[model samples]
Target: MDKHNYKSYRIEAENICVDYHGKVALYDANLRLKAGQICGLVGMNGAGKTTFFNALTGFVNISKGKIRINGESLRIAQKYQAIAYVPQSEGIDSQFPVSVWDVVMMGRYGSMNILRSPRESDIQAVKDAIDRVDLMELSSTPIGNLSGGQRKRTFLARAIAQRASILLLDEPFAGVDIRTEKLISELFIQFKNEGKTILLSTHDMIHVREFCDLVLLINKTVVAYGETSEVFTPENITSTFGGMSPDVLLGPES
Candidate 1:
């Protein structure tokens, strides 16, 4: 990939810093995500992954730096319509009387006017998203009733429906079964093929190695960021994760 392709810079962060209350979550964190690529943000628990996501999505105010999309300065409105954030927890309330289809349609609320209801095209988009995630059978079912893996798929479908060029997914594969993980990996590939930029925070190093074109190792600050194979070295992994090697941590499954 051309390192300085301005057109490919879907998302760019310059010295981003965030503090929650009195605690610093991220300090001088910088990253750039190009189009048609899947970049993995890997770090241990409490490594400021979600904090960085919140900062990028404008859900949390940053103390320093600027985040831009397509070379334009980022705004909350830009974040709403141009960026899709899939958090670790499925935000859908299982007990709520909302169907999976309805949940997916909610993603379009950012673009919908107050006076207008969902158009046929909007409905079609929702259907297409559900189909993409293989959640068509459960489209009419309650989201709360689905298993953990199914819940992840549902949120991914919601992101797809949003039609965002930049997708930020946090721990999307956590609690998911092997099959579901594979399916999500394939979905990432599909997104890449469509020229979408995906930034996912995950603990699955093996998956990162296999699927991600780039990897950013972050722990409050960016330790390393580059091609997966080059950045995920034994020395780099050990430094990032306190001496735990991939073979010991991920094992043969990796």
Candidate 2:
């Protein structure tokens, strides 16, 4: 695709509504995330951050509204193939008997036919992703033996191997150390420079301010969505977090 054409790889949600058992998790949320932007999702627990991501990634059925990717409206099933999601590491069973290599290759399964084995290119992609995340030394290690940061990097490598235009991450920085967090932050910037779109949910306002270009504040609905600087003000954050001040949440540096 032409560079100009590729720039249109944006995500548009029109009045998105998600409900569970008659309870609204997301209500009439509408937002447009442009290509190559890293959008940070912020809201209190139970305020619908994960719910919005689930609806956007098609993990849950939306009660009402529509989503368009690159100008084409798509159903939930179709959206799955169009985006890559790296859910929280806690969701993975650390005891699962899988090697780092095996875990990363799962990302390629979506592109393969049923009952087919990985081809040479798939193997190479997995290797490249591992190397990108500086996991070559641990590539053969079992996932159960890896540290929390290593496990997070392993999943990030998997997402990179998927090569999707849109990436969704939930709490990626949760258990990571400062160095690993910096590495992941740099990787996100690299993805952005390569024209990929990213939406990540995080509670750390500091990282949100430092890493994300855009911010999506949700409190059962979209309280604000725009450039990080504009949407992360004390007023908007207070609207979503309730009783919290931006200075206290973001700290002095932010």
Among all candidates shown, the one with the greatest TM-score: 2
TM-score of each: 0.91, 0.92
lDDT for each candidate structure: 0.84, 0.86
**lDDT tens digits by residue: candidate 2, 1-254:** 66555347478888999999998888999877777889999899999888888887778988899877766655643535568888897777999999999999988888877965999999999999999999999999999999999999999999888887888899999988777898898998899999888999999888888889989998998888899887788899877888787778777864
Candidate 1 C-alpha error for residue 14, in Å: 0.5
List, in order, the clash count of every candidate structure.
1, 0
Candidate 2 residue spans exceeding 4 A from truth: 1-9, 75-80, 252-254
Which 10 successive residues of model 2 have the least lDDT summed?
72-81
Off by over 4 Å in 1: 1-6, 76-80, 90-93, 244-247, 252-254
